[model samples]
Target: MTSSPLPSGHDVVVLGGGVAGCVLAARLSEDPRRSVCLVEAGPDYGPGQQGWPASLLNARALPRDDVWERHTAFYRIRARVLGGSSCVNGAWNTWGSNADHAEWTRAGGERWSAPALEPYRRRAVDRMRLRAAPDEELSAWASAALEAAGELGYPEVDMGAPGAPGRGRPLLNAVDGVRFNAALAYLDAQVRARPNLTVLSGALVDRLVVHGGRVRGVRVILDGRPSTLVADTHVLACGTYGSPAVLLRSGIGPEAHLRLNGIRCEVDLPGVGANLSDQPGVFVPRSPTPELDAALAAGEAAGNLYVSRMLVRAAGEYCPDGAWNLHLLPTAGPPLFGKLAPGRYEAGISAFLMKPVSRGHVRLRSADPCEPPVIEPAFLTDPDGRDAAVLRSGLRKAQQLADALAELAGPSDPVPAHTLSDADLRARVGTYWHPVGTCAMGPADEPGSVTDGQGAVYGVRGLRVADASVLPTVPAANTQLPVLAVAEMLADTLRA
Candidate 1:
């Protein structure tokens, strides 16, 4: 809603001012010598939480406002605001197992290892002010879920770091029911006061001006006018969906696809918009007992009602030993989408298939920057049927937890989830909203590898990608914390 004249250029231009973008901008701009410009497609909301909308500031529920597309496919839903998905996510932060780090280390060498990234992870945790769920914040359902996991003989493990798979509460970025987004955490008043940092919001990136195997400049539509912002370095932090789309539009994607879209191919990278991976889950609803409903209503009235506060990190049949592939989340509160009757609420156990093998893609419909890219999650579509089988295993585990809480809630589904047909499972599947691997990191010779271990694009000089888009594989946990740590690590790489 506000407009300002664009500076001619900067030392570094961080595109997409989301979670990673904010962190990159904040860290890269720490040195007064480096002039860093952060461009976001959505509103900046200025400094602090006061200017943010009420829905975005509340951690009790995932806000639909400030998102890219409302009422769209759940998997396609992404935040368009400055803080990115953190502005609209569950505010829960969890870490992955050593196996996740092993997979990353394979693609990106030792830098992607657990021990190597630990320092940056700690920095992100402290900066974001992540804290464990307090006892007072847990509702009766969440409390029971934890008890049930222990009753089922699962050991308690820390959810915010690398450890064996088990049951525990995740670290939250919210405190006292208020969501602390990345913009608030990283782009604080002190960071914004830096004259070297320029945040340009409501600017939609059209394409990169690539020439001679290097980024010459970037064209963005700001204040209804098209302008070019030049920089010595261009960092793509536009996230999984937006990052790949920007590459394709810039004629840096698959040559065949670029030709079809009538865009001149500057780079023939085959992996630009491919290898999309995301976590998908199915919610098994339950009928809450009257007493449970009354208790939840009380929590709601007191403004302490949280949909979910705990989860079980369970290993699937195909999972490697000492690692988990499923998250059994038990939730009971106001429905995420629709409203329930006055005192009634929605209670369910959701089985999320973490680390899914099924890969999807993002493709440009045309060269138009305004046109939303075609996103195919391709959930449960692995050829070997491994993804679907793992999901079924998770569903059975969720049913076990639900059974443990039978006194508080009863099964509302006519049939158990594990027993459901493949078609039925596909129909009921929803995403964890953790999409990654569009501009994946790996060896340059690999077919689908877009970036190297250090996030430098295969053939592009003066360009790098520092976001979830570069993650070669999805970790077996929520992506918020991992992404923050990743951006921190990449910022260090840039600084060095």
Candidate 2:
């Protein structure tokens, strides 16, 4: 837990003290013999006590502090903190469906399937306190939305329960109105007290110190001072954006791109920063009634942190059964959201494409580690136009959800839905902020597989990527629960 100069060497060095890195650092340090060091780019509120930001403390809305730079068209929201985005994100916990992990089986065989992932899932679930809030916990607006959803045939049930279809109240990972982020969950008081584990904040890693095809250490800028950390094992949990950047700066990406960026190629892996995927979404906002506005505000003070109580899992008319897709959740919130800033108290349905076919890629803009690379999501670019079609249908679904609640949310003024053209929908869409798949995992020879089944880098030794970046495909869920499971599952292999 010391925040001073990091030890010169350790058994393991974990880059990015985000969700997965926190879990990895904690689990690996379990064995007293293993010395673990975790580096983070943001300040750590040591032991989650003093100096906690008000935005992070309030669960009513996710913290909107920008952690990374992004092109205006591709607004990639990331939380650069000790606990990562889990500290500031909407606390929606979902594991997607069994089908979500089926794609993983193609690369990692049964080891990556839902059944195989369950044990790790259980381990993660066991580690945290996650469950649906009491029905009475819902604000008046959320209550009305839930009832409206039920009337529209969406039932109340545990969406995370195995075989539980449709939607109910989303399970949250908050405790007593505060975010139960990675630091609080995995690096608890006892875990922090362990002498073998070291956590470093404000340490941004520039590149891996690689030699002889083996990763030896990391070159980091700790509090504006340059230093190198040597380790027996180096895990890149720098998240989708940061992790890939580390690889690229270390001369391990598309050879042509590396050369163009003035970085010498150490490993000409074409998939280092390719295959980026995220949930493309848009919010259908409306003016909130005076009653709902008061309730939304008052609920925050009463330990009712969220704007919504229930989520609607829709397969829509086009996709059903194992092919379940589309997520429509009613939102009632203040102007705290990053994209919805300076906004009035409003209520609306936030609909997103659950399994979009569109794909995107990330490319290095420069060899400098501090420079943000170009993130071209190319959202809604699928050839068949299915992605756009789904989002368009989602607008209709939101309109239906709103229509069911017209008696309550009947906006004092109208918003575009019926009048808005398909082109309008395309222009209004934003990110769900669940970016993943940059450092995708698969069989070594797979075209864009950056890591092997066990999360090992394809052409490197003593280095691996264990985070949202390694996901072979995007899970049609909130991703926090699943991402935690990935770290927990890999902890064992990493331990061995």
Candidate 3:
């Protein structure tokens, strides 16, 4: 985005234009007096309009980013568009559960509870204009998957219907074949028309300009030129990865680690990039049957059948009383709108291992803001072996579902759970990309918490975090709606 003549100084500055960042910025700028500046590391395509890349705007397909890498073979897919992962992800509105909120309340007080945050989730859904994909919209594969779920004793119900737990249709954040992301839903033309908000896309925030134990401004790199955008209050809404990396780069992390990374430690908060967690998932795919292929071909001709159905449940020992701990996303049709093959027919069940106890970390490779941070999301590395156990059960469940499909389609095949041992399952684990808890929240006395109940970074002044990085643990479901709720709560608490 071209630099405008907006004032350099502002009352509030929100960094990162992701889901939480977009909503937080838009919500905070409603004062009509608070001069808010939003900084993003990606391109701003204005709103949903033509000439924008079809890869990013296509709701039925997931776009890939070459820049988002990790320390392992598993790819970390994060969108670089203004709406962040909300733009690229399978725009499902799974609000998690009350048990999930109980954990949040335990870590960040009662305000983070589900009862307190349910209104925000509703408001967020209303703003995003989410709707449940109708049962008729289910593809042939999805229909058979649902049938298999019923055969396996799983309930056929709406996955996000509050306390009801079972497999059913998923609520999607899309409208008319387009993704209703945070940028379009919250920060649209009407919201951006407000004079108090100045959004600067393609601007990289290098570090926080901390002076006298308070953030004065941010050292930003815009269009390859360095500049500083001064503000009284600075909020880091840069999701799980970018948020903590910004803190570490600003010398607000573990002293020795920051020093080892060739940076001076301004604050010895050890939890800046610690306590990272993510949902590990795997895909068990099957070759499509002739009937499934024919049905898909018909849908392909008509541009219909965007099936986003799922099975949310507590498969094994992590079973809670009223909530699910795992998600089995069984989908049909081409992956990424024909990115895999021209007309290849396939079906896959994405098994998500939620309620994971494994924790990870994000370390800065160097002080350069452009250099990607060394992300170490140690998936399935739980010491208690519970994570692997849960994943094994979920994979077995997915294999059973796949087996049901194979039986209906006339090809009996074995997936990883049927063929490989539990030890093998450990080697081939991948994330659902729902990374959270890098900058966890807790009391100051605790060792791993970087923020308090109010998202105030411990020992910092006029600075706070308003993103998924502040979550104490990864929620039991998709992180989009939960992360948006976190931002809404922060916006309600943060001063003007």
Candidate 4:
């Protein structure tokens, strides 16, 4: 990695170097005429950080200085690198269907509807060469599972077409046996070639530089020095909790919430930190195959099936998308996972809800930039909610898929017994870690919406949010693809 001087000024200033921020910065700087500056809070990504090998992508394995462990009252979320979470995420590339988008729009997400964002969808997928089967052969488990779903009358939607549903193979951004983060795609030679783009790492933004109800720049602490960087336009891509925390520090949020924290309101966007959303997943470990055992022994890119059940509630009716996706991961050895003795392991099946109705919030804890934001996700807290119901459905689907593999392979194979119930299965699941919507984008009239359809902050001129935080609802797939689509849309809007 190389180092550079902080830009004195630029036409556009993007806060946070996550996937969305990086992609937008690169796209905005495509024109030699427009200068762009990006500020990242962590150290630059090193050589080993790139490429596959899930073990290396763990938050614990990343350099301590480069990874920030934000501690909230609940739990800690890791993110403190130039590429943001993408640098550490599993990088599963799954896209949602139009039906899924329509439901989001109907559920208070206006600009995020499927039809309205088709162009970005195409662009996001087209940007990379993603195939359903990169290993060139389907695992016996995957093959039997699809055939079982067909035999069981579960409509198989072709996941390749985001609008269609079927038992589809995992379409990954895992390129050449390596992990592809936003930093690689947006900040490679193309962005580097542009004299207009400047990236500064190890810069922790403290607050938005708001002046007379408008954003003028950002005040950050770089290397223990308090500095201010001004710009014509300011974009916050810091992420869900990060963006809201910064805004609250700068006095933008619900009036009561702000005043209680002793902050004078500059922008009373009540929804600034409301409507939090995320999709949590769980893992199912199979007995290891000889190949899987070998990969686990050698430390390679292990894959899995990331599947979700699509369900919606509106007008007292229920709609199921009847489609799901799975990521096939190739793993390192058992020594890394501790799941087995050196050779006693199996590939795993990771299943979760992609689009969940459970909502949460990101609020100021102590008005300290260093303090982690209060993240409260009321997961399954809503007993009468659809999020819980759909998650239950996902559990069933996951079990079905797992059961199908039993017939394809004998008891000696990877997959184990099918005696577990849905409840037993759900208890073993956790999160896929795609959190969004803390700063939802929609019309101002929408009570909990933060930014407008065009990615503009309500009541704050020259301020915009282009990241997963702006999503009104989590999509029915891995969020990296949708985050990229949102950035592509925002870039076009900025250019227009």
Best-fitting candidate, scored by lDDT: 1
Estimate, for each residue in 1-496, the C-alpha lDDT of model 4 and write its tens digit.
1246556678888899887888788788888888888888986653334433454344223222344663322123656877777776645566776655775576445556666677776776666445454433334344445566667555544444564444455555555445556676668765666677888889988998788988877898888888888888998999877888888988888988989888888888888888887775555555555654553334333343221212111111143544333322222223323445545445444455666667788898877788777887656555565655555555445555555554332233333223344454445446667788878877677788788777888888988888888878777667777788878888988887
| lDDT by residue (tens digit), candidate 3, 1-496 | 1237534878988989999889888898889878898888888878555636776666777666513553334445566668899878878777677787888888899899877887887887788887887665677777777777888888766554466467776678876567677888777778888888888988887999776678877888887988888887899988888999999999999999999989888889989888988998776767776777788878777777674555546555577776777788877777633355556666677678888898889999999999888888888787888888788788777776777777535433444653566577766667777899988998889998899988999988989998999998888778888888778888999852
> Which stretches in model 3 have alpha-carbon errors above 4 Å?
1-3, 65-74, 335-343, 410-419
Question: Where does model 1 exceed 4 Å of error?
Answer: 1-3
Local distance difference test, candidate 2? 0.79
Q: List the residue pairs that clash in candidate 3.
A: none
Give the alpha carbon lDDT tens digit for every residue of 1-496 in model 1. 1136687579999999999999999999999999999999999887888888999999987888798888888898999999999999999999998999999999999999999999989999999999999998999999999999999988999999989878899999999999999999999889998988889899999999999999999999988889999999999999999999999999999999999999999999999989999999999999999999999999999989999999999999888899999999999998877788899999989999998999999999999998999999999999998898999999999999999999999999889999998888999999999999999999877999999988999999999999999998999999999999999999999999
lDDT of 2 at 353: 83
lDDT of 2 by residue, 17-86 (tens): 9889988988999999999999998888877545578788666566766366444344566778888878
Model 3 scores what on Cα lDDT?
0.79
Residue 383 displacement (Å), model 1 = 0.9
TM-score of each: 0.99, 0.93, 0.94, 0.81
Better of 1 and 4 by lDDT: 1
| Candidate 2 Cα outliers beyond 4 Å, as residue runs | 69-74, 290-305, 317-320, 336-344, 411-422
